[model samples]
Target chain A: MQKQKIIFISLFVLVIAYFGGSYLYKNWYTQNLDFMAKENTSVFIRPHSPIYGDANAKNYIIDFFDPACETCKAFHPFVESIMKKHPGKFKLVLRYAPFHTDSYYVVQMLEAAKFQGKYDETLNVLFKYQNRWASHHSPNISLIWAFLPEAGLDVEKLRDDMKKPEIDAIIKQDITDGKTLGVTKTPQFFVNGKPLIKFGYKELQELIESEL
Target chain B: MPPLQKTSNLAWNILFLCWLTATIATLGSLFFSEVMMFPPCIMCWYQRICMYPLVIIFFVALFPLDTKVVKYAQPFVFIGLFFAIYQNLLYYKILPESAQPCSQGVSCTSDYINWFGFLTIQMLSLIAFSIILILLLFFKRKAI
Candidate 1:
C-alpha cells in the first residue's frame, strides 16, 4: 500500500510538471510573434512593357519578392545563377512587395541601392545575411554601407537615395502591380507578361525557352 | 491470480490506454498544424520527432502483446521520455534555450500553431511522455 501511494504521488507530480511547462512555453511563443512571424499580403507587379516573345532579342522576367520570405531566399541563388549563365539574353526586373514588416526596409534599401547602380550588390548582401535580420530586432545599416564599395557604388549617393520619396514611390508601384496580378505570396514570377504558375527549375527553364 | 499479478495487469491496461490517447492526440496535432495552416516552432519539431515514430511503434507492440514486445518498446519509450523532458525544460526556461537563428526566410522560433491557449508542440510532447512513463512503470513489474 505504501509503495502504491508513492507511485501515485510520482504520477501526480509528473502531470503537474507537464501542464505547468506547457503553459509557460505557449505564452512565450505567442508573445514573441513580432520578431518571429510574417504577416500575409496580397500584392503583384506589372513590367514596364509587355513581355512577350523577344522581338528585339531581349527577354524580360520580373520576380516579385519579399526579402524576409524563406521561399524567396531559397529561390534567389538559382535565379542569380541563371542570370550569370545567360547574362545579356535576360533582363531581369526585381520588384519589392513586402509581406512582413521587416521586409519593407529591405525593399526600401534595395531601391536606394538601385538609384546608385548598386542594386545587385545590395541584393546579394541582403540575401546572404537574411537569417540575421529575420530573427533579430533590426539589421545593421552600417553593414549596408560597408558593402557599397564592393557593389561599385558611391556610398554618399546610396545613403542620400535611401531618403528619397522617389524610392518609396517605386516600391509602392511594385505593390500596386503585385495586387493587380493577384499575387498574394512571395516569389511570384512572370515571364513576359504571363505569370509562371508552376515552380521548379525545369518548368521555369521550359517556359523561358518557349518565350525565347 | 495473486495481488501482484492483478496490479501488473491493471498497470498494463492503463499504459495501453495512455499510449493510445497520446498517439491519437499527436496525429490530431499534425493534421491541425500541417494541413490546417498552423505552423510549428523549433521545439514543436523536436516533439514531433519523438511522437511520430510511436504511431508505428505502438501499433507493432500491440501485435504480440507479450513480454518480448514490452522489452523492445521499453527503450523507445524511455528515449522518447528523455527528449520530451528535455524539451519541457527548454520551453519552461529551466535549461538554457538555444535554437538555430532565423534566416531570411525561416524563423526557427516561429510559433505558427497554438491550440487551447496552452497546447504548444512541447506541451503535446510532455503529455505523450507522461503517458509512456506511467505505462512503463506498470509493465516493469509484469516483466519482472
Candidate 2:
C-alpha cells in the first residue's frame, strides 16, 4: 500500500511539472511583443511613421491590416468608431498587409480610389464588402465598382488606377513593411510605435488615452 | 521468444496508430485551409512543428532500429508534449490572468479549429504524451 501511494505521488508530481512547465513556456514566448517591434524594417512614410503611424501627430496609432482577413474585418468597426471619436488627437493610417492573395486586389482597389481622395470611404466599403470579394476563387468585380459612386470617386478613374503599377507598389510595400515588423497576422496595431501588449477595443482605448 | 514477438507487435501497432492519427490531422488541417479558407494562426504553426516529426519518427520506430533510437525519441516526444500542453493551457486561458500568449494574431485561446468542443491541439498532445508514457512504462516492465 505504501509503495502504491509513492507511485501515485510520483505520477502526480510528473503531471504537475509537465503542466506547469508548458504553461510557463507558452506565456513567456507568446507575450513578448517587443521582439516583433524590433524586427520591423519596412519603409516608413516619414521618420517614425511606418505605414499607419501618424506622420506629424504626437500620439499615433498604426494598424497593420489585411483587407481580406476576417479578424481584420471584425476589428474594423471598433477602430473606425475610435477614429470618429478622436479625429485630430489620433491620426489613423491604414497599412495594407495582404495575407491572402485576394487581399492584394482589395488593397490595390483601395489605393486606386486614393487618387480621387475617396480612400477613407473606399476603405469602409472594402471592409464592408470584404467577405463578398475575398475568396480563393474569383471575386465579383462588379460589386466593387458599384461602391465607387458611394465613395465619391469616378468609376473610370478608379478602374484605371486598379491596374496601375503605383497601386501595386503601395500594396507590396505594406507587405514588405509587415514582414520587417514581424507582423504575422492581421489587425495588429502599434501605439506611438510601440506594439500594444493587450488586444480588444477597451484595452486599445485605454492605451491611447494614457498616451494622450 | 513469444513475449519478444508480442512486444514488437505492440510497439508496431502503437507506432502505426500514432502515424495515422498525426497524418490525418495534418492533412485534414491543410484541406480545411484550402476548402474552408481559414488562415492558420501562429499557434497552428507551433502545433504543426510538434506533429510533423511524428510522421518520420514513428516510421523509423516501426523498423528494427537500435534501442538508442527509441531512447532518443522518447525525449523528443516529451518536448513536443510540453509545447502542446503549453499551447492548450493558453487556449483554455488557465495560464495567467495577464498572459498575452500569442502576439499579433488570433490567440491560442481563439479555438479556430475546435472539433466537438474538446478535441484541440492540447488534447492531441495529451494523447501523444500518454502514448509515450505507456511505451516507456511497458519497456521498464519488460526490463524488470
Candidate 3:
C-alpha cells in the first residue's frame, strides 16, 4: 500500500509540474507580446497586399509568408480559423516573402490567379498541394501547374498574366518591404502593426485577440 | 531514522515516475506524428530512436523492480537528451540552418506546435529525458 501511494504521488507531481509550467509560460507569452507591441510600425501592411476576412475590420494581421514554406502551409488553417472565430473583428493582409528558390514562381502564379478573381481558390489549392511542388530542397515547380485545374483556374490566361510586369512588381515590392522590415523567415506576422516577439500559434492568436 | 527510509521510498517512487514519463513521451510523440499528422524532422527521428527503446526497456524493468534498468537505459536517455538540446538550439536559431541535418526533408527548426509560446516537440522531449535522467540518478544513489 505504501509503495502504491508513493507511485501515485510521484505521477501526480509530474502531471502538476507539466500543467504548471504551461500556465507560467502562457503568462510570460502575454508579457512578451505587450512588450513587442509598444512600438507599432506603419510599414507592416502595404496597400497592394491581398486581404482576407473583413477588409474593414479594425484589427489587422499583416503576414509575411512564403508559399513554399512547410511551416506556412501548416499555419494556413490556423490563420483562417482566427477570421472564422472573430467574424468582422479582424482581417489579414498577406505579403509575399518568396524565401525559397521556387517560391517566387508560386507567388507569381498567385498574383495571376488574383487577376482573374481566383485568389482564394488558388491560394487554397497551393497550400493543399504544397508538399508536392513547394519543396525547399527539390521543388518540382512544373507540378504546380497541374493542380490549377482543380482550383478552377484557366491555365492559358494564368500563364499569360504570370508574365505581366505588374505581377513582377508586386512580388518585388513585397520582397523589398519584407527585407527592410528584417523578415528573414516565412509566416512572420504582425498583429495591429506590432511584430510578434516569438513564433507560436498561441502567441499569434493571443496577440490578435488582444488587439481585437 | 524514518527520514532515510522516506528518502529511499521517494527515490523508488521517482523511478516509477520516470517510467511513466517515458511511456507518455513515446505515446505522445506517436500521437503527434501519426494521428495529428505533424511530420517529424530528422532530429525528431534521432530523438525518437533514443526514446522509443526506453519505453520498452523501462516497462520490462518495472514488473521485476529491477534497478539494473538504469544502467542499461542511461546511454539511450543521454543520447535523447543530446538530440533534444541540439534541436532546441536549431529551433532558437542559435545554430545555423546550414548545420541542420534535415536538408532533404522537413526543416528541423519548423514549429509544429509551440504550446504556450515555448513548448515545442523538442522541448517536450528534453523535459522527458531530463526527468528520466534525474530520477534514475537519484535511485542509483539510493541503491534502489
Candidate 4:
C-alpha cells in the first residue's frame, strides 16, 4: 500500500513538473528575447522605411509587412491602435517584404506614394481593398491601380514614380534584411529590436505594454 | 480482484469511467500538442495542471478500491472544469476579448483546429472534464 502511494505521488508530481517547466521555459525565452542584434541590427531600419507615430519615439517597432498578406492588413489597425494608446511613446517603422505573388507591384505603388507624401493613405487604401486585388494565385495589379484614386494621388506622377529604380532597390534591401532577421512570414514584429517570438495578437499587446 | 467485487458493480464502473476519461483526456491533449503540432495556450496549461495529477491518483486508488480518492481527486476535477469552462468561453468568443488570457497567439487569440467548422480542441477538453466530473459525482453518491 505504501509503495503504491509513493508511486502515484511520484507520477503525479512528475507529470505536472515536466509540463509546467516546459510552459515556463517557452514564455521566459520568448519574453526575454532582448539579446539584441543577433544579426546586423542596422538592417532593422532603413532611411526609406516609412515611419509612423512620433519620429522621435524611443521605442522603435520595426515591422516587416506585405501589402497583400491578410494578417498584416488585419493587424495594421490593431498595431496602430496600440501606438495610439501610448501616444508618442513608440514609433512603428515599416519595411516591405513582397512575399506574395505579384505583391511587388503593390509594394512599388506604396513606395511611389512616398514621393507625393501619400504613403500612409495609399497603404490604407490598398489594405481596405485588399480582397479585390491581392491573391496567392495571381494578384490583380491593375485592380490596385483603380483604387489608387481613393488615396488621392496623381495617377500620372505615381506611375512615373513607381518605375523608379531606387524604389525597387529599397524593396530588395527590405527582403534581404528580412531574411537576415528571420522574417519567414508576413506581419512579423520586433519590439525595441527584440523579436516577438510568440507571434500572437495578445502577445503583441503584451510586448508593447512591456516596452512602455 | 475479490476486493473490487465486494463493492457495488455500478461504483466500480463509475470509477473505471472516471479513470478512462482522465487517461483519454491526457493522451488527447498530448496528441493535439505533440502529434498534431497544435500549441496549447496558457489556459490549457492551467487546466492541464489539474487534470494530469488526477490520472495518477485515480490509477492508484482503483487498484486497491480506495474510496478516499474522492477527497483529493475531486479537487483537481473541479479546478480543471473551471479552467476548461473559461477557455471554452474565450475560444468560442462568448467571452469578450478583454477577458482573453492566452498570449503569443498560441492560446485563445488564435484559431485552433475547427473540426466541421464548429468543434475545437478547447471544446474537446471541456467535454472530457465534464464527463469526469459527472462520473465522479455519480460514484460518490451511489457507490461511496
Q: How close is chain B to the truth by TM-score, in each candidate?
A: 0.68, 0.71, 0.90, 0.88
Model 3 residue B129 lDDT score: 91
Candidate closer to the true structure by lDDT (higher is better), 1 or 2:
2
TM-score (C-alpha, index-matched) for candidate 1: 0.47
**lDDT, residue A166, candidate 3:** 90
Ranking by lDDT: 4, 3, 2, 1
Q: Rate the local accuracy (lDDT) of all candidates.
A: 0.61, 0.62, 0.79, 0.80
Model 2 residue B47 lDDT?
61
Point to the candidate with the largest DockQ: 3
Indicate the residue-level lDDT of B84 in model 2. 73
Candidate 2 lDDT by residue in tens digits, A1-212: 54335335644664565556555644553444445434542332323222332345556567888766777778777766776676656666667777664657777777777778777788778767666766543455556776657777898877788998866766777777766555665787876556655567788888777767
Task: Give the local distance difference test score of model 3.
Answer: 0.79
TM-score of each: 0.47, 0.52, 0.49, 0.52
Per-residue lDDT value at A89 in model 2: 69
- What level of docking quality does candidate 2 show? incorrect
List all candidate RMSDs to the true structure.
Answer: 12.4, 13.6, 8.8, 12.8
Could you give the DockQ of candidate 2?
0.05
Superior by lDDT: candidate 1 or candidate 3: 3
| DockQ for each model | 0.05, 0.05, 0.12, 0.04
TM-score of chain A of each: 0.61, 0.69, 0.78, 0.81
Candidate 2 vs candidate 4, DockQ winner: 2
